[model samples]
Target: MWDKQVMKPVSEPANSPSYVQVRLKLLRDIATGVWPLGGRMTLSDLEARYGVSQSPVREALLRLEGDGVVVLHPHRGAVVPQVDAALLTQVYDIIGALQGMLARRAVDHLTRTHLRELEAHLARFDAALDGGDIVGAVAANGAFHGMLNSLGGNPQAKALIETRFALAQATRRLVGYSSGRTAEVKQQHQSLLAALILGDGEAAAQVLVAHADTARDDLIARLLSKGAASTAS
Candidate 1:
């Protein structure tokens, strides 16, 4: 079920030329299951829901299709696809490796200011998790990674990482976490932060890989369990 609070309009950027704001809102909503698995919705419905115009709605949906979150049909509107474990495995594997590369390269370039920014984001993550706000935690987690990925100064890498991050956001909503699971994630972030502060790129990369692996395994378990329950019922 979609949280009503999440459906509210996201704060927008003042100078964004493109409809990136609309895209993000749509991505977050879909990722968080404002529209459930395999659910169908037309552009008009999305326009009304997000208070965006037709073109931006269309653009957002097309971008989501590229990310493997939603599919478009000629006469069937847009539908969220069934979760594919194998595909997600491949995506996570590539993401983990690329993320490791980004972190490894970022070590030499990261400044004290960058480290402080990361610490701030990590603090946000901790507070969000403590409050049991999954959406906020996810946003903060993404920001933490975004800061690190930015330190590498690789635009292409950042773009790829953000895309994969969007896809992963979808999974987080599907595979909702227990408090213990959330705690584990928080610990992983702490470990990554410690490694970064020590200038241990290898250790940071290793933590990033392990973090992705843990997420992959947990999400697969949850999706499989959900499928089984649906089948049995």
Candidate 2:
């Protein structure tokens, strides 16, 4: 049975930019695990499901491919890229390195305005957690990290981090950490933002590393528990 909570609404973005709307819907589905890892995604299926023309779906798939969320298989069509434990570890390590560098650099450049924006994001996250809004929590989490990367000022690094973050989203969702650890995750974000505000690169990096480590541990434990339960059943 498909979990309804996993079936996120595919709402059109404001202004309803045709191509972007299609792309956003597809990305949302992938992020929410509606399109599970290694699952095939057919153009025809997307076109029928999204009620969009083939062109937009194709473009979206191409974009997702570039982001490492989808792989173009010669004989198999587009499939959600699988991240094994080794690969997941590698990706998170890279994420920690890139984000550490970015945050360190950003501390020197983080403006008062930027800090205010980050604080607002944190507030939103807190509100979402208090209200038990999982979807809102996810969105705020993305916004907070996105703002951090954007403020870091290296477009190339930012692009890579964005891709890695998307991959992490899939992993996080699969392990049920995306919403379940909201309070702990929000606190980590607050700590990182504080380090950034104080222009403490070392502190910021340490916080981020800890944050990533916590996520990795949670994911591993969750997957192991699921496997054990499945075997017993």
Best by TM-score: 1
Candidate 2 structure quality by residue, lDDT tens digits, 1-233: 11144322222347855666776676667766777777898877888888988778777777777766688765445898876666667667877788888788777667677789889988987897688665566678778877787666666776676666666677666655544566678789889988998899999988988887777666667667766888999
Distance (Å) between predicted and true CA of 33, model 1?
Answer: 3.5
Candidate 1: count of backbone clashes, pairs at least 3 residues apart or interchain: 0
Give the per-residue Cα lDDT of candidate 2 at 143.
80
Superposed on all Cα atoms, model 2 deviates from the true structure by an RMSD in Å of 8.5
lDDT for predicted candidate 2 compared with the true structure: 0.72
Candidate 1 vs. truth: CA RMSD? 7.3
Tens-digit lDDT track of model 1 for 115-193: 8889999999889878878788778887788778767656677666776666677677666775467879888989998
Cα lDDT computed for each candidate against the true fold = 0.76, 0.72
In Å, residue 153's CA in model 1 sits off its true spot by 2.1
